[model samples]
Target: MNKEKWAIVTLSQDGVALAQRVAQQLDDKMCHIYTKEKYAKQNMQVFDTDITSFFRSIMDQYDIICGIMATGIVVRAIAPNLGHKSSDPGILVIDTKGDYVISLLSGHLGGANDAARLLAKRMDAQAVITTGTDVKGSMAVDVLAEKLNCVIADFTAAKDVTALILNNEAVALVNQENCELDGVVLPNNLELLETSRDLEEGKYAGVILTSMSRQKPEFAIPSVQLVPQKLVLGIGCRRDTPGEKIIAAVAATLAELQLNEKCIKAFATIALKQNEPGIEEACKQFKAKKVIIPDAMVQMVQSRFDGSDFVFKTTGLYAVSEPCGYIASSFGKCLLEKRKMNGITLSVWLPEK
Candidate 1:
């Protein structure tokens, strides 16, 4: 099923034992346990020692860390090396006694809260979620949007609509079947009347929820457009280039394309020896995964090149390339040869219909 990777670190023997059990419960493949003198061994990968090199080495490899057993010392030792907190992976701290679960870093942003809750349930312990939005049972659209990788166009309107929902007003809109809502006034006369009006009129006061990309009919309310923003960035760079130059080119490219840094879900390019440095650097800068294609595949794709090919080759979506005269010229021949270079070369696609 391709579960997300997680790293587990523990210092005390009891902590290490608990971590091993939790790893088994979660069916995790990569778990690094820090312990002394190998007391008891489980299915998880155990690293017997407290050296800084050991901690740094594991941190560099895994994106998320689920800390179990040890709390103060383990967190203190590893906290300094965790640069760029915003981009770091989820870090959850659990008590050795299996009584409480706490999300330390990337709590809501990186799914740490979710992970902690899930782990707590397995241990029959309390999931201590202190986030106000979740506790109030109101709409947490922004948090959901981030977790789902979707774009929310109108932030102010979203908050206002959520406020209305929390007031026990029946707002006209759609919702996921599994959505959590409390004190919702469903199918009231006022909501029904507003539902028939245009969304721009501000008559409706609810959110329109759908996984599909098609726009809904006018509902006389402010709509928060929820569309997945994953994009594939196609990069063409010189051989053996430094990472800085590639990052600069990508920054310029994103700016030209009117795209956010987070919009880029992945990177794609033809396999080139010199392109590795730049590609690696760009991945780190954008926090994106790089998918390198064989030269033969690149050639075949180029033969059928369209501006969308730039994005498709990388992310399997029709995306507009960041406009760069130099980049365009270098790849123009392929695009033109395939008769794919229309006036609108770059285009972003919503998910499949």
Candidate 2:
């Protein structure tokens, strides 16, 4: 995951210093500071004393707030303002002494839980996580797959496997070493068989079992396998398109292709023009990385195009456009395009493993 921006507010000089150290440790940008009595009036990286002004400035500048070195006063001052925004960044409180890190808001959804754990490790403090999912060590498969950018081929089998892990039961599998079993169960009895076929054919009544390879045994036993999906989709869309439309198009295309959303790793587009707010929103909504291409490349791609009235030329392979002619000519393959909407296009390109 890309590092998120943080605003650190501290009353003491020591707090400021600690905040700086934490920022450096996390490799995140620290935009402003709030101190006692005196507000340093400066631009870009400014410092302020007035609690309201400092908080207002923070509200405008950073995505997440890492409250360090300040206790009840800082949190209480900012608590009211935090309520107005739904997408407010994760709010974390760290002691000046650096003994503990607590995620005060947006703990699970906004990635505060993960951030707190990371900050704790860096600060050598305890990560105070109260989320049930983390406590149980059984993260949702869909959520995990979304965060990791991996696929869950068989949803039914995946559910059963995840359930076993959550219950902490031992599951038998071949090549267990390669799998990430952080929250999985392993069987105590490891009767080595000649082949995976033997295990697959034999029924183990207890927990889920799986194999790394695809050769199924002659006899059938219930097991789950984690497989990598090898499809990369390139997309093009009209300027100023909303994320919902693009998402709808992508989802529809994937459904048509009989593919799951987890198969997608990342998305790329020309960086020349302003990014469609919808596309940016969609990337965040889908937890997919959106890459914008350079302007010079967009111009080059435009030069090669011949057939469309809707001309959006960008250096990136994916050009957001409304015209089917332009979308078809622009991309090597027409995975999907806007039929009812004025502008939207998608192209599926498989990445080389």
TM-score of each: 0.60, 0.52
- Each prediction's Cα lDDT score? 0.55, 0.55
TM-score of 1: 0.60
Candidate 2 local lDDT, 1-353, one digit each (tens)? 54457777776666767766776686654445555544323332445446655675566456667777555765776776675223556778888888888887666545567788888998889988875546775554434433333444566765665565456543444532133446543234323233354454334422222332233233243445443433444456666787888888877777776655645544555544336687787676655666554545554454443334434233333233322222223344434433333476556654322
Model 1 poorest 10 in a row by lDDT: 335-344
**Residue 125 shift from truth in candidate 1, angstroms:** 3.2
Question: Of the candidates shown, which would achieve the greatest TM-score relative to the real structure?
Answer: 1
The digit string of per-residue lDDT tens for model 1 on 1-353 reads 55677777766778777877777777754555555556546454656556455566666566567666556765776677676444567777888887888877666656777888888898788887765555665445556556455545556755665556656555555433223334443423223222233334444456555322333344445555544445555555434567776676656545655555555555655444224776688788877766555544454444333445555565443322332211323332221111122221222222121
Q: Model 2: what TM-score?
A: 0.52
Query: Which residue ranges in model 1 land beyond 4 Å of their true spot?
Result: 1-3, 37-61, 70-85, 139-142, 151-228, 273-275, 305-353
For model 2, how big is the CA root-mean-square deviation? 8.5
The parts of candidate 2 lying over 4 Å away from their true place are 1-3, 11-17, 20-31, 35-64, 69-91, 102-147, 151-167, 171-232, 238-247, 261-267, 271-287, 294-343
